[model samples]
Target: MNSLSAFHRPLGSTGLQVSPLGLGTVKLGRNQGVKYPNGFELPDDRQASALLDLARDLGINLLDTAPAYGISEQRLGPLLRGQRQHWVICTKVGEEFENGHSAFDFSARHTRFSVERSLQRLETDYLDLVLVHSNGDDQTVLDDQVYPTLAQLKREGLIRAYGFSGKTVEGGIRALEQGDCAMVTYNLNEQAERPVLDFALSHNKGILIKKALASGHLCLHGEDPVAKGLELVFAHPAVGSAIIGTINPHHLEQNVATAIEVLGR
Candidate 1:
């Protein structure tokens, strides 16, 4: 097993590489209505900067945030600051949450607008990856103007890669056939998304595992369900990375160490 400081892998054929454990930032911005077992106070700018510094110290290079995740993109902009080149930023389009409700727009216009807005919010000229934040209608969103718009953005050098964080296997496959990555949910309690992971691996498409700890629910009553969950997730040859969003530095370090132990990186 290798330490988190030694884990870096290619992201399919996008010409970009990332660490085996990408840091997710949902908890950083949104706290109005979250599903985490415990309540949390949103971190101030200083704390967020420290967290980024810690993640960098731990050798984490990939960051997963989305426009829909409250002000995560905006917050990261200033925090990342001069060190922006050190991280692979993976953000999303198609959905927005405000006043405790989510509204989705998969239109070509909205997709392009969203990417431009994300770039502005992140204070970056280009994005490493941009995924379609599906509204559970994965196929429909893919079939709509969103995917094509992203493809165009890629051609124009606005985004390096495009992907789908979908809700179904059918949609996951569709996303892969297009030669982009898919963020699927796979954990001890829910394995229904295994087929999606398998497809991505067999076809050489990138696979980023979301909810690897079942969105923080897996540790509710377990001796250590997270270790068990990540052990299973990184064992597969096709597993590219696992996005774990932990606000606590200790928890983040432990998760990375556990992955290092499991994958023998």
Candidate 2:
């Protein structure tokens, strides 16, 4: 896209080659109580479209969204139309945000309903990937019939791959063992979850690095903490991609450049 060095790789054994960086859409929808050091107004349609175009131009093909991400799904439904072919959309199930609180429903019926709603909202017949948005009780959710429901959806062709965006090392590993991918945090401030990536590498399951920059907190001191964080995550052979949400096009471009540098074509 932007004449950047190539840095695409396979997402586990899913047969889909994806960019090493994914654009997270939480910022595109929600701005309340965000963890960023600075706050900004939500982008309107024109700005959102331009941002997506810029991401594509920068060789970022992955987009991460969730129902809990405020109006993200509804907003992207139209914004992503006609450009769906170029993105690997990864939306979530099991968590819904309303009136400033999160609620979980991972039952088979609700899971099916959520998938249907996501498909409708995203204006797509199918999703490239889906992750269980754990409410910190990762194992309990899986045990309470979330994973099985998603597995059924995979068989039904609603999602190409399914995994867990887990909060614990054990839960992440368990998700990988049973599912196609595991989204975990692996930044400079946190290395306790590195075992999850190791397990994914050994088991050939996909590993998506969440909070690779600690949700923007990592940039507080260093001149290039984003680059430093990406270097740390991409150094691991297990990492499939790092999902970073930023409305700033310059930051996205800089991130892509940093990723290519760390990955080294």
Candidate 1 residue-wise lDDT, 1-265, digit = tens: 2246567888877777888899999988998777788989888888888888888888889999998789999999988889888999999999899999999999999999999999999999999999988889888888899998999999999999999998999999999898488888888988887898888777888889998998888854646787789888888767778999978888888887777777674
Q: What tens digits encode model 2's per-residue C-alpha lDDT throughout 130-166?
A: 9999998888988977889899999999899999998
Cα lDDT of all candidates, in order?
A: 0.87, 0.89
The superposed Cα distance between candidate 1 and the true structure at residue 67, in angstroms, equals: 0.9
TM-score of model 1 vs. true structure: 0.96
C-alpha-based local distance difference test score of model 1: 0.87
Model 2 scores a TM of 0.96
Per-model TM-score versus the true fold? 0.96, 0.96
Among residues 3 or more apart in sequence or in different chains, the pairs in candidate 2 whose N, CA or C atoms overlap within 3 Å are none
Best by lDDT: 2
